[model samples]
Target: MYLKLLPFFPGRVCTIQDPLAAAVSFDGTVSTVSDTSCSYSAVQDGYSYNPDSYVYVDFDAHPTVSGFVDRTEHVFKDTGADPVTCPADDIQGCSFGPVTDKPKEINDVGTLALTTQLGSLTFNAILGVNQITTLYTDDTLLIFAPVSKFDELGGLCGEYNGDPADDLTIRDETVTTDAAAFVTDWKTDPNCVSTPARSMLRYHDQTSLCSGVPQETVSGFEGMCQDIISPHMNITDLAKDECLQILCICNDRDIGACEASLEEWFTTLGIVDQRKKDPLDLAIELQSAFL
Candidate 1:
């Protein structure tokens, strides 16, 4: 699933695609920036109050991302978003930017690298055959997975097994068209209320329960808040309706949150914006932000 979707609805659990091709599950919990916070108990339990903005990716698989293999998990928190210190044993595993060590591209073992951008994460897949790029800004996390893993993965992003007919595979390996059931099964924390009282938050209601208000009025760079989807893509009304729940329970529902969410959505959906160009393409051209 796109990390950008996480902050949209509180308490919704999803298993997202990890940079190392593994599935990592997490729940959209409270928003440190909003008053109508959900999953406060879970936050007290030390879970992230804002799950998608900054995260700690627990690579449950091979842990092949270099510098982190020795450690059980690696934190992907952008330095500008949240300053963190690596464990003494795995200091090298923390690749905070602006990284002066590695080049843009290399065939060496995978490494969790952060870009110079204030809030972003970068890492090359094993053998440099794939690249996983993520940016966390404006309270949104945008993920761009490498096409090389096509047909070999499954999760909220859908089963990439080359069959769109079965894109709704749930946690139990069963396929279901019910979106609620799909989300419930992938929750990392059962204590979270995965299901909200309303299926879709209404915009007409000014109450905190109306998540659509923020989405409809979101602002981006230069006051341009249009979603930039790829020309090849077609967004359904159902899809748009489903996404309205993002702001209702966010911790920080201010302009920054709205802008960040919109920015990442535009980036993930694909298109070149005058304010923010495609990050991956820019990384390649500059030859200074990857590897």
Candidate 2:
């Protein structure tokens, strides 16, 4: 399954980890999605692009998957060209920033309304949703979003305000209405619609949050069950470790891909542990419900 890079195609598999490092390096739902993020990579505003109508990346010009492309200065950037605004000193490689802002066409596997919203983190950070440079000063581009757009993803970073989710919340979430407006702003932004990386993550985040797989099928819980109910007592030790493992995978932003891994892990565990008299059923059930 090779994703052919287009236009000035850099030929590198668009990765989630780099974008994440530019944003937040924490290990949470968003972080996991960031690390495992890999999209086919596309030039958002390429040939045949329509600002009025929706356009998506495809081997063929008429793609079934719909997403927005970047409409910013470097909106029409090609691997062949330099970033329109980047200075040579700021970026070492090419005129542009080595094609970091992916095109929406490449990562629109999940049916989504592609936009540049960063996710609930942006709203939680209260970084002024509208690409406020002074506030979002990290080297890599900052994607600003709200939980409604991120839906399920918000829960990952948006907890009861005291848990690990709080670590990422730099601002006050008490202002939910403003955060909601941020989500709208990002979605309507022409620039965000152009970049695939930003838009793809936004879509996947919402898709996962909105349409998560059934709890029992998630691999994290399944693996936990296998570990805890194992023939040996040390299984308990292993079960404790799976929380991070599953959650970490979920953070990659590709819910479907992570869910696939979870399903596989669970299938293998179910087969291997079929014979064991599992005392961890209750615990596993609890974890599974959360997934």
Top model number, lDDT: 1
Q: Rate residue 69 of model 1 by lDDT.
A: 13
Worst 10 residues of 2 by lDDT: 1-10
Candidate 1 lDDT over residue span 1-291, tens digit each: 123222111111222222211111222211111111121111011122333222333222223332111113324433223423232123344344233334432213333443333223332211112333443322223344433544433433444433445555554567765545544433444555533211211222234334334544433211232242323134443223323334333223243443354345544333322213334443353244442
Taking all chains together, the TM-score of candidate 2 against the true structure is 0.22
RMSD of each: 12.9, 18.9
lDDT of each: 0.31, 0.24
**Candidate 1 residue-wise lDDT at 98:** 36
What's model 2's overall lDDT?
0.24
TM-score of each: 0.40, 0.22
lDDT accuracy of residue 179 in candidate 2: 25
Query: Model 1 clash pairs?
Result: 1-157, 8-246, 31-251, 32-251, 33-251, 33-252, 34-251, 34-252, 138-260, 151-160
Off by over 4 Å in 1: 1-108, 117-130, 161-165, 188-280, 286-291
**How many backbone clashes does every candidate have?**
10, 25
Residue-level lDDT for 263 in candidate 1:
43
